[model samples]
Target: MSSATVTTHTDDWVRHLLFDRGFLASMKGESIKVYLTMLTACGGEPDRSVTISLRSIQDATNLSCPTVIDSLNRLEELGLVVPTMRKSGRVKTYYIPGVPPEN
Candidate 1:
């Protein structure tokens, strides 16, 4: 039998969330899922933000609307995700922090 190799790169923000903040041990699985989905959307960059809809998140995570909302709220409470409302006041952009820029 042949085994497939799995390769992955760990970003600073991911490390911060998992190790520094100990979120993997403290946070709910749904919250972690939502946080990761947002990070993937933004390419895990603190400088870049993702403008995504709640429906999209629900679709991606296969989570209910209420569950997704609750997860987002939890992430916000932990200061892991920052959300800003657009001028339209209808759309929100999410920013993931904790990753410092490279020198």
Candidate 2:
């Protein structure tokens, strides 16, 4: 008997926090976009540190830089996203907690 090994790719999967009542009730659409961009916009990797760029977030959410900043501030204020000192070159990153898969 011969058995073939299978390797499944997880690079296409991303994780994010659930939009529960309290979270949804509190966050605006812009803020939500920011949340989602952080969640799935980055390359689906296992790293807890999300190394996404502002341009990437803006492109994913179709929001202006100022709007994205506003949303990030709101998310940070509400403890949805935590900015870390970690930086990939000049880009900033966030440390996600218990983030789930998005696809």
Candidate 3:
């Protein structure tokens, strides 16, 4: 038995749950990009908080701050993301709840 086997065969059931809840429907281009970025931070703990700054998302998505802000607002309106105060006393932090990996 190898450690890699356990890792590779890990049963990630989050995808099925996301599908049941309609998160897959929102997986489009930019939306999917941002959602994946946040979900990656979840590290299989989908229920945990996935916080990322606007600048980080902007860099990853190659989108301007305003564009990212608009997209985030849209996601917030859809109840996918919630805005929260940052612990570092800097810009606002975004919390992506139960974010699903891109399709």
Candidate 4:
């Protein structure tokens, strides 16, 4: 077998859910990238309340801390990822649950 990691074929799915369904297409470029990256990282778990750390996302995406934080904030503003307060003395955690329909 090949030593490469078998990534999930999620591009079409993301396109369908975010674009074809008219959710994220209206978002900016950075916002779209971060949102799609989070969705891809989240996998098939249906728990919308699932939480993750910025460091984890930065490591996964190979992005800097500030970049990850900025993108995450944009997603939050767009009603994509939900932010939660972590008990780590004001450190925050974010959950990339799917967004609601953009009425």
Q: Judged by TM-score, which candidate is best?
A: 1
TM-score of 2: 0.65
Model 1 poorest 10 in a row by lDDT: 94-103
For residues 1-103, could you state the per-residue lDDT of candidate 2 as single tens digits?
9999764343222212344325666789998778767766444334466867788888889999899888988988776677887566646878664443333
Model 1, span 20-101: residue lDDT tens: 6576776799998998898889876665678988888998999998999899999887777888765353357887776533
* Residue 43 in candidate 4, Cα distance off native in Å: 2.5
lDDT of 1 at 14: 75
Clashes of 3: 0
Candidate 4 per-residue lDDT, tens place, 2-78, comes to 69865554555555567777766567666666665666566743234545666767767777788877887777776
Look at candidate 2 and tell me the lDDT of residue 76. Answer: 81
Runs in model 1 deviating more than 4 A are: 1-10, 86-90, 99-103
Clashing pairs in 3: none
Candidate 4: C-alpha lDDT: 0.64
Question: Which candidate leads the pack in lDDT?
Answer: 1
**What tens digits encode model 3's per-residue C-alpha lDDT throughout 1-103?**
6555443311355555446667668555676677666666656554556657778888888987877777777677766767776667435666655544445
C-alpha local distance difference test of each model: 0.78, 0.68, 0.64, 0.64
Candidate 3 regions with alpha-carbon error over 4 angstroms: 1-13, 86-90, 99-103
Residue 9, model 2: lDDT of 44
